[model samples]
Target: MSRPERWIRLRGKPRGPRAFRRDLAETAPGLGAGDLTALLAADGDEILGWGLYHPSSQVAWRELRRGPEPPDEEWVRAAARAAAERRRRSPEIDERLCRVVHAEGDDLPALVVDRYGDLLAVELFSTAALPLARLALPELHEALGTRHHRLALDAAAARAEGEAAWVETSPGCPELVQVEEDGIRFEIDLRRGHKTGFFLDQRENRARLRRQVAAVEEAEVLDVCCYSGGFALAAAAAGAAAVTAVDLDEEALAMARRNANLNRSRSIRFVQADAFGYLRTLAANGRSFDFVVLDPPKFVPSRRERERGLARYHDLNKLALPLVRPGGLLLTCSCSGLLSALEFQERVRQAARRAGRTARLERLTGAGPDHPVRLDFPEGAYLKALWLRIT
Candidate 1:
């Protein structure tokens, strides 16, 4: 009948420690004993993921995947292969730089697979997904036809899961390779450069930026926090007269230079500098552009840092708005999960006001459709983009 009713429908009891009974109250507090039992059963189809649930924590599951049949090597390989196939069809995605297996998106929880050129990067966010990663590696290699595989275990996800910390021997590919999106190529490392190498979730936003770039006739463009030049390349391709791409990462700036060249856009100038410093420099120089892009990384990681992050965002736009000529465009974004969309916009408005610049909101967008957000789970909606016109 209804979506919520259909989703709640379950059958039978799940097999686990008797402690699971005790955990029900603490784990999924709102769910009744019967509802928890039905969740475990899965109507006899077998669950791909299960375990001690922690509804309170951002990570809600201890058992990533389980089934009627043992989830062994074959199953792991098949799952990895299936996930890769799904990403292969997306024209916007560079197969080399993508989320081959996006945890819940691929029906595999606590697992993330990123493809960087010839290398494959794997990160396990939960204990249940670790063994599956080892089992699935060979299959991932076979499916993608790449031997270079690197496992990144730097984050604290392991500690939270009560698992001993283990150093990852492999770091996916050796040298970074070029990943092209919308005629823009970026060199991405399997070992570093944000989540699983590159921000693949910003595919649609980059495309939208490109379209706006194409409409402007010889517009001067500024791309702040120009990680690997995704937005810069798009603007350059759209024929921006002078595109200045700024980033603190030397490696990323080098990649951005290559990306500019790949698109045969000589009009772009790559600058290696802190985004905030660069904005201040622009303001001091009294330089203004027809288009300004502020796509910084996550400023706030948790709720505690939200106010500081919001303040940073406000100050960033305050400096950036003055660098945008009146009647020009400002594309601002926030990838912080800690901040909500309304709060981000309010911060931008505050920034515009502080800069003595009035603006009209043109558009409000989020992560691409591929990175779908479940109606019940707002955490999935992380990226927020706003297009504004300086008045």
Candidate 2:
């Protein structure tokens, strides 16, 4: 489809590099979200960059380029190659399972590619990104040697970009496939599960949790919102004294149970309940753990839901802090890209104050090395984690 030429004018100074509708001085009358065009100044003298006009989104359009280096077909191909080459060069990341393309992190905004064993799960988050990503499937297969591809979109992203969320796989690729991460096996439900059926971004965090649990003698662990039991299983394998995994999704819990058995573990107590309520119950019952993981799903996917999401984070930490025995560690995480690491840390601190617990920050981390973030696109630096020591 031929893209229409529109005066993509900038109006206000955006806080970050991203441009929202409020920042836009003008938009094309009939431009599609994925349609590429040059950005302009209000006076129309400067061509700021290129963008994918996303009218349905809060972000009118994310910057595709800061210069006139067109994101043409060749640019897309090079991006695909560069993204793949970076992952292949990362000796620290397991090739068996890792993120190959991290949207804006790879300079290809709104498109993510995750490799699970033989399957490549491609998630397109914007109309602008969707076409470019689709056009590069052949290149991805050639570079990665993976013919099995599953392309999909989450509901929120789909709605924001005015695109239909779908699940389509290459011929002969099963909807459910088994993949290994750091020697632990997991079953990925690409068609039904959330965000490509696994949280690959938390790979390093899980490893760190395992190390923490194994460091202590007879360490008791609590994993809140333990979807598919990644942290719980890791802790169990580390020989924790006891591990309690809690989540609201029955299906995810069932999978977690199966994973535990696969790892020859009968010790993990898998509880199906709301994490918030469960944490409150555990605290009221005077239950405590030597280590705890609060890996909740994204409480806020967009800026509009930021208030409620921050509240949940604050309250969750408040309840969870009491469960950590003195000198124990609490690894709390937020996947909401909208929440800055500083803001998230403040939330935890506020929660600690409310709970009357002394919490000191020990380490601050984010997604594994596989999920690299671009320097310009700080938005790619979502997934903030705070490792705190409770006294």
Candidate 3:
């Protein structure tokens, strides 16, 4: 069936960075609340694009489809199927745990789907996508060959939209599921865990760490902010002599311990403490590691927090650099979309200088290919990792 073309007008010429939010001159009167609407220029009735109108949000409208053509159910289904096919074609992705859809990367805004074995976790970022997501679920199921799925809503977005945090579409779906990646097993609880149960974005990075650790016999490793022991277990399985995983969340530490036991990674030690304080104590005790990974949560969520967030990143790296022995490896990362890759690299350089160490950048990377970024949407490429060697 053809979708209805509900139209709304924009204030000025749409000549700027492509963003979810578009400035409005005026909206069509009597438009249904939160319905998908066609975006038109103020001068004429010509349809500019398609967007979701939410009067309550600061971004009154979120553009969904760009250009004249409006999107329909078939369009949404095709996008979802294409996203799934891309993952299937990528040899780097482990089918059991991979991102099935990366929202805007797939040209489907505000919708993300991650596959964990038979379970599919769907996250809706905008209210407009909620209806479209409902239409795409069956298509997603057919494309991914998974009937079991759950809607994992962002807590903040849920509150903003006046909806529940999470909802299960299928009955008898388990709270937790076991999945494997690169020969390592993990237990993921989609309902309670962060970002659809596991950090699938770091899958490749962890594999890289494993390979690097395997090259160094008896490598002592430290994983800061090690949620659920991804890097810790990877290093341990790679035959690291000792791996310490530190995080502030006790629950995460418990899960990390369980993951360690599940993988029989006895070399990892789980510690629940503030990463900064722990790093300070390690430095004071003159303790050092052959490899250190600093993967903190999003320090800069928005542009307003960039200045303070950069300072925090600088301070954290300053403390972390000293904990890496001479000739040792340091893998630091920032998930903040507001911090550019160049800015993050410069901060790390300053940190290295303050630590009185000369560092060589071995590699600069980001999330796995599963989390693909659209060239036009740089914000999608939020994860920045710098692999350095300190001397």
What are the C-alpha RMSDs, in order, of all predicted structures?
7.2, 2.3, 2.6
The residue ranges of model 1 lying beyond 4 angstroms of the native Cα positions read 1-49, 52-82, 88-97, 126-128, 138-147, 156-173, 261-264
User: Is 1 or 2 the stronger prediction by TM-score?
Assistant: 2
Report the Cα lDDT for residue 347, model 2: 93
- The digit string of per-residue lDDT tens for model 2 on 1-391 reads 2233754777754344467777877776887767786777666546667767777877777666776555678878888888888888888988768998888787777788899877899887765677777766778788888869988776777776667877777899888888877678887777667788889988999999898888999999999999988999889889898999999998899889888877888779999999988888898898999998999988887777899999999999999999999999999999988788999999999999999999999999999888888776677889998999999
Greater-TM-score candidate between 1 and 3: 3
TM-score of each: 0.75, 0.95, 0.93
Instruction: Determine which window of 10 residues in candidate 3 has minimal summed lDDT.
Output: 14-23
Question: Mind giving the per-residue lDDT tens digits that candidate 3 earns over 2-54?
Answer: 32456666667764223233466666677664577877767887777786776
- Give lDDT for model 3: 0.83
Across residues 73-100, which tens digit of lDDT does each residue of candidate 1 receive? 5666787788776667777555766667
Per-candidate total of colliding backbone pairs: 7, 1, 1
Clashing pairs in 3: 11-25
Residue 269 of model 2 has an lDDT of 96
Reference-based TM-score, model 2: 0.95
Deviation from truth (RMSD, Å), model 3: 2.6
Whole-model Cα lDDT of every candidate shown, in order: 0.69, 0.83, 0.83
CA displacement after TM-score superposition, residue 47 of candidate 1 (Å): 12
The predicted structure with the larger lDDT, 1 or 2, is 2
